[model samples]
Target: MANIDSTAAIHSHQSWIGIVQIITAATCWGTLGIFSTYLNQMGFSGWQVTILRIVTAAVIVLAMLPTLWPQLMKLSARQWFGLAMQSIVGVLGMSVCYFFAVSYVGAGPAVALLYTAPVFSLLFSKFLLSESITRKSIALAFMAVFGVGLTMLGEQAEVNWGILLGLASGMCYSLYGVLGKRAMHDAHPAPLVFFTSVVISACGLLLLPETYQTYTQLLTLPLSTWGYVLGLSLLGTVVPFGLYMKALEKLPASRASVFTIFEPLTAIALAMILLHQALSWIQYLGVTLILLAALLNAVVNGTTTRVPRWLKRRQTV
Candidate 1:
C-alpha cells in the first residue's frame, strides 16, 4: 500500500511539473510582445526584428550543432520534411505577422488577435490531423469568431491590413502546433528547434531581400540594444520554445493550449507596465471572450475526449 501511494505521488508530481513548464513557456512567450514593441520603437521594422530573432536563434543553435548533430541525424526524411513545413508556416509565418501586428495594432489588440490561434488550431486539426469536427468543437469555434469580431470593436481597433495580418499570424500559429504535433511525434525537441531555426534563417535570406537593409541597420545599434536582442533571442525565443516543445511531450496539446492563456495575459500586463498600453473595457471584454472560448473548448474537448478516444489514439499512431 505504501508503494502504491508512493507511485501515485510520483506520477502526480510529474504531472504538475509538466503543467508548470507549460505555464512558464507561455509566460516567456508573453514577453515577446514587450520586446518586439520596444525594439520597434528603437527603430527596427517588424519584419527586420522578426527575422533578426530567428536568425539570432539559429546562430545560437548552430553553436550547439556539434552536440545536437547525432540526434538531428537520426531524423528520417519525412521527419525533416515536417520540420521544414513547421519552420516555414510556424516560425517565420507566425512571428512575421504577429510582430507586424504589434507594430501596426497596439500590443493589447495584437495579443488578442494572436489568441485567436486556438480557433484556428481547432479547424486546422480537423483537416491536418484528421481530428473529429464534432458539434461541440464547431460551437467553440463560432464563439471564438464572435470574440474576434468583438475584438475588432476595441478602443484601438483599426480595420486595416494590420488587423488582417494579426489574424493571419494567429492562423499560422495554429498551423505551427498542428504541424509540430504531426511532425514531432516521439522526436526530441532540441534538434527540431535547431532545424527550425536554420530553415527559418535560410528562408529569410532567400525570401526577404529587403531585410538586407534591416541587417545593415542592425550594425549601428548601441551596446545596450544588444542586451535586448540577446534577451529576446535566448529568453523569449529559445528558452520558451524549448520549454513549450518539452511540455508537448508530456501533455496533450488541448490541455496545453489552455495554459497558453498565460501568454496573452502576461503580454497585456507587460504591455501596460513596460509600454503603458491599455484598451477600453469593450476590447478587454473581447479578449476575455476569446480566452474563455479557448478554455471552454479545452474543457469540452477534455470531457468529450473519452467519446472520441479514436482521435487521441490516432495521434499516437
Candidate 2:
C-alpha cells in the first residue's frame, strides 16, 4: 500500500544524505575551539565556561522536554545508570578538561590533542563493552599515542595543564562513547543528551564557588557574549550532535568516522585564520598521523565487526 511505503520511506536510510549530514556535523564541531577560546578571553575561567555551555544546552533541551519525554520514559534502569555515569565522567569531565585545554594550549594543539580520544576509546571498549582487542588495534593505538606525544612536545614556560587536561578530556570522551552506545539501546540520542546536559549543569552549579565572583564580573557582559554562548551551544554542540545522530541512523559508522576527521582539520584552519594559533611542522605531522591511524582503524573496525576482535571509537562534541 502507498501508506505503508510512505511510513517505511520515512525510516529508510539515504546514504548520501547521511554523508552530508555527518560532514556538516563535523564542521560544526570544529568551531568548538574558536567559541571556547573567545569566551575564555572574555575573562571566564575554564570551569565557568564549561558550566555556562552545558547550562545553555540544558535550558535548550528543557524547552524540548515534551518531545523528549516519550524517549526519556523508554529508558530502562540499566540505561539510566549508564546515562548517569556518562553525565559525570563524559559530559562534565570532558567539558572542564577541554575548556582548560583550549584556554591554556591554544586551539590548534588542543584540538589535535583531543584526537587522542580514539586511542583511549580502544582501551575503554575492551573493558566496558566487552569488545576484543586486535593486533591492528594495538598498532594503530601506538601510532596515535606517538602522534599525541608530538602534539605536546613544545616550548613550555611552566607546567602545562593543557596537555594533561586534553588527554583527560580524550579519556572522558572515550568513556562517553562506550557508555552512550550501551545506554542507547533503542533510545534516541536527543533524550540521552538532554539528560546528560541536565546532569552536567547540576554538577556545574555545585562548583559555583569557583565562579561566584566571576559572575559578578559577568553581570555587565556585552550582548555579543550571549551570542557567543548561544553559538557555542547551538552550533558547536546541539546542531552537530543532532546531525551526527541523523547521519548514524542512515550510514555505516566507519564512513562516518572517516568524514569526522574534518573536525580537527576545521579546528586547525579556523584557529590559524581567526585565533592566530599555529602548530609547528612536527605537530602538523603528528595530527596527520593520528588522523590516518584513526581512519584506518575505523575501516578495520567496521570490516571486522563480526570476525576479528577489534575496538571502535565514536566521538562527539
Candidate 3:
C-alpha cells in the first residue's frame, strides 16, 4: 500500500509537469505569427519566411544528428516513407498555407482558422481510422463549423482568398498530425522532428530560383531581423516542439491537444495588444465557441478505461 501510494504521487507529479510543458509550448506557438510578421516586415514573402524557418531549424537539428544516429538507423523503409509524406504534406504544405494566411488576413484570423484542425482531425479519424464518433463529437463539429463561418464573416465586408487558404492550412495541419502519429509510432520524437525539418529544407532548396534573391536581401536586413529568424527557428520550432513532446510523455494526446487552445487565445490577445488589430464582437463570440467545442472534443475523446478516476470525475463536473 505504501509503494502504491508512492507511485500514485509520482504519477500525479508527472501529470502536473506535463500540463506546464504543454502550456509553455502553446504559449510559444502563439508567438509564431508575431515572429513571422516581423520577418515579413524585413521584406520576406510568406514563402520566403517559411523556407528560411525550415532551413534554419534543419541546420540546428542536423547538429544533433550524431546523437540521434542510432535511433534514426532503426527506422524501417515503410516508416521512412511515412515520415517523408508527412514532411511534404504536413510541414511544407501547412507552413506555406498558414504563413500566407497570416500575410493575407493577419495573425489572429489565421491562427483561428488553424484552430479548426481539431474539427478536421475528428473527421479524418472517423473516416480513415474508423474511429467511432459520438453524438457529442457531432455536436462539437457543427459548433466549430459555425464558429468558422462567423470568424470569416466578421473579418471584412468582402470575402477574400485568405479565408480559403486558412481553411486549407487547417486541413493540412490535421493531416500532418494524423500521419505523424503513425510515422512516429516506434520512433523517438527528436529524430522524427529532425528528419521532417530536413525534408522541408530540401523542398525549400527546390525553390531556389525564387528564394535565391532573398539570400542577398537577407544580408541587407538589420540585425534585429536576423534575431527574429533565429527566434522563429528556436523558440517557434525547436523549443516548443521539445516541450510538446515532453508533455506527450505523461499526458494523453487528447488532453495535450486541449492545451493548444492557448495558442489561438494567446495569438488573439497579442495581436490586439501588439499589432493593434481588433476583432468584431461576433468574431470574439466565434472564437469562444470554437474554443469551447475544442475543449469538449478533447474531454470526450480523452475518456478511456485507463483514465484516472480523478480526471474522469472532473470531466463529469
Candidate 4:
C-alpha cells in the first residue's frame, strides 16, 4: 500500500508538470498569428513565411543533434521511420496548413476552425482509444463551437475555402495530437521533435517557389520580417510543440486538450490590439457561451454529480 501510494504521488506530480508545460505551449501558440501577420506585412508571401517558420524551427531543433546523435544512432529502424513520418506530416504538414489558413482566412476564423480538434479528439478517443465521454464534454464542445461562431461574426469578406482550410488544420492537428501521444508514449520528445522539424523543413523547401530568384531575398529579408518569422518559428512552433508533447506524455488526450481555449483567446486579443478589431454585443455573448462551455467540461464534470456513462465513454474513447 505504501508503494502504491508512492507511485500514485509520482503520477500526480508528473500530471501537474504536464499541465504547466501545456499552458506554456498554449501561450506560445497564441502568439503565432500575431507574429506571422507582422512578417506578412513585410512582403513575405504566405508560403515564404511558412517556409521560414519551419526551416528556422528545424534548424534550431537539429542543432541538438550533437547531443542527440548518440540516441539517434541507436534508434531502431522502425523508430527512425516513425520519426521521419512525424517530421513530414506532424510538423511541416500541420504548420504549413495552419500558417496558410491564418494568412488566407485571417487569425480569428482560422483559430475557430482549429478548435474543432477537441471534437475530433473526443470522437477518435471514443472509437480508437476506447475512452469514454461525458455530458459535460458535450456541453464543452458546444461552448467552444459557439465561441468560434461568435469569433467569426462580422466578416465583410468570407474566407474563400476558409472552412476547408480550417477543417484541414483541425484534422491534421488532431492527427498530430493523437499520433504524437502514441509516439511520446514510448519515445523521448527530442528525437520526435528533431524528426518533425526535419520533415517540416524539407516540406518548406519543396513548396518554396523559384520566384525567390536570389539567395539575398531569401536570407536578407527585412529585420522586422525576420523578427516575426523568428518569433513564429521559435515561440509559435518549436516551443509550443515541445511543451505540448511534454503535456501529452503526462495526460489523457481529452484532458490535455481542455487547455486549447487559450489559443483563440490569444488570437482574439491580438486581433483587437493589432488590427483594432471590435466585437459586437452578440459576439461578446458568444464568447461568454464559449467560456461557459470550458467550465462545464473542466470543472463541472469532475466535481459534480456523476455524468452519464455514455458521455463519459465518449470523452475517453
Q: Pick by TM-score: which candidate is best?
A: 3
- Candidate 2 colliding pairs, count: 0
lDDT by residue (tens digit), candidate 2, 1-317: 99999877765637778989999999999998899999998988888888777766776766676766787778678766677778888888888899899998888877777778888987788876778888998999999888887776655312378888888988988888777766653344755565665655555565667545655666689988888888877888888888998888888777788888889889989999998887778778877888888778888887876421322333321
Range of the 10 consecutive residues with the lowest summed lDDT in candidate 1: 303-312
- In angstroms, the error of model 3 at 182 is 1.8
The 0-to-1 C-alpha lDDT of every candidate, in the order given, reads 0.79, 0.78, 0.79, 0.66
lDDT of 1 by residue, 137-199 (tens): 788788878878887886678688778998999999888877866664545465555466455
Each model's backbone clash number:
0, 0, 0, 18
Candidate 3 residues lying further than 4 Å off, grouped into runs, are 155-158, 185-190, 197-207, 304-317
The 10-residue segment of model 4 with minimum total lDDT is: 207-216
What is candidate 3's lDDT per residue for 92-128, written digit by digit as tens? Answer: 7888898888888888888888878878987886665
Off by over 4 Å in 2: 1-13, 74-78, 156-159, 185-190, 193-216, 307-317
The Cα RMSD of model 3 versus the native structure comes to: 5.6
Worst 10 residues of 2 by lDDT: 308-317
Model 4 misplacement above 4 A: 1-22, 127-139, 146-153, 157-159, 185-216, 242-260, 284-317
What's the ranking of the predictions by TM-score, best on top? 3, 1, 2, 4
